[model samples]
Target: MFFATTALALLIERFIGYPDILVRTIGHPVQWIGAFIAWLDARLNPESEPGNRLAGMLALLALLVVTGGLALAVALALRKLPYGWVAEAIIATPFLAQKSLAGHVRAVADGLDRSLAEGRSAVSRIVGRDPEQLDRSGVARAALESLGENASDGIVAPAFWLALLGLPGIALYKAINTADSMIGHRSPRYLAFGWAAARLDDLVNLPCARLTGLLFALAAYFSSRTSAKAAFAAMRRDAHRHVSPNAGWPESALAGALGVKLGGPRAYGGRHVDLATMGDGKSELDANDIRDGLSLYGDALSLLAVIAVLLALAF
Candidate 1:
């Protein structure tokens, strides 16, 4: 049932995506979670307090309890309805973002075709790096990297949790991820308070990140860009070089698969981060590279769908 639910949700999201009307009407689950996190942070994480770490933990715990309990109740209620698995799938559909991820990445490519300024603007919507600092190659790299990393975060992770624990599991994971995004950073303001959110997000993403990389490797094998062996080898060698414990997996895999080098020094906000580069391929990127990356993303998603179907059959 879990597998079927996951498969259906993925398919629906792939074809139609979340409708704008629905989003405008009820807002997103993540937005609601973010609002709650913001409220908690405002009340509990005062910078003047030295004990914000504990307060942050308490806030996170409260959030988990509220989100999990509400999700479980919704799941139970859905189970009482006719064709409840379909209902569960509908509820879960918005959580997966394969179509949207691919769309945004493709839009970056389209924007690059127009001009560098447009490219930077398009890529900025998906990445946090300072767009003004990025050149043509940098903009393309940013888009590809965002596509690879978000493939895991926005698509595979939710599917993984949903398969394991159904709707409530995915809900809990989304809540944790949202909190991490909202407050997980090295800044003095968030370093202690956001530690739990960041660590938990990393823990939950560990398996999914690797799995997403493997899927990309398979996609590379199927495509003409690069071989699966090269993708896997690059991932093993370069994945550790990334600042993120998990992000490096898919990013490196895609870099190797596309015969491009990624993850060199880049600026965030105003600070320069001298990070190790991934892949031994070309450093220069263009609009074509973005297209290739999107293709790889699509192929990897297809691979994941197959796995989901197999899991459904097996269990």
Candidate 2:
């Protein structure tokens, strides 16, 4: 049941994606989760505290209970209806983002095809660093890095949780991720207050991050242009060098597969982050590299779907 629900939801999201109209109408689930997190942040998070840590933990607890409870309620209600698993799958579609990730990455390449300025503009929409600071290669690298990291965060992790625990599992995972995005910062304001959220996000992402990397490696193995050996070597050698415990796996895998270097100096919120480079390849990436990265992403996404379907059949 879990595997079938996951497979159905992935297939549905792969085709239609969550529409902007739907997002604009009521708002996306992540936005809703963000709103609730904000409320908790305001009420529970004090400016100064020997209590912010406890407060943050309480906020996280509340978020999990509410999110899981509501999703479980909806799943139960839908199950009472005919073809309820189908309905659950539809409801779960918005949580997984395969098509949209590809779209964003493709838009970077499209923008670069027009002009460098337009490329910077398009990449800015998806990345956090100042777009004005990036050259052509920087823009391409940013897009690929975003594609790699978000593949795990936005799609694989949620799907993993969904297959493990159905609707409530996926919902809980998203809640954690959204909270981490909103409050799990290293900034002074969020530092102590967001400790629990950040740590928990890391814990939950463990399995899926590595899984996403392996999937990308398999994708590379199947492709003539990319190198599976490089991907695997990078994972073993450079993945741990990344600041993020989870993000490095896919980012390094994709970097090696594409034969491009990723991760270096970047500015964010006026602060410079001296990040370690992932792949021992050429740093001069162009728009075409971004397209190649998207091809790799598509292959990985297909592999994930195939795995889910096979698991469904096996169990």
Best by lDDT: 2
Candidate 2: RMSD to truth: 1.4
Model 2: residue 167 alpha-carbon error in angstroms: 0.3
lDDT of 2 by residue, 1-315 (tens): 599899999999998999889988999998899999999998887565433788899999999999999999999999899899889999999899898889988999999989999999999988989998899999999999999999999999999999999999999999999999989998788888899999999999999999999999989988899999999999999999999999999999999998999999999977888999999999999999999999999999999999999998998
Residue-level lDDT tens digits of model 1 in 192-216? 8998899999999999999999999
Runs in model 1 deviating more than 4 A are 47-51
What TM-score does model 2 achieve against the real structure?
0.97
Backbone clashes in each candidate structure, one number apiece?
0, 0
Error of 2 at 139 (Å): 0.6
Q: Please list the C-alpha lDDT of all candidates, in the order they appear.
A: 0.91, 0.93
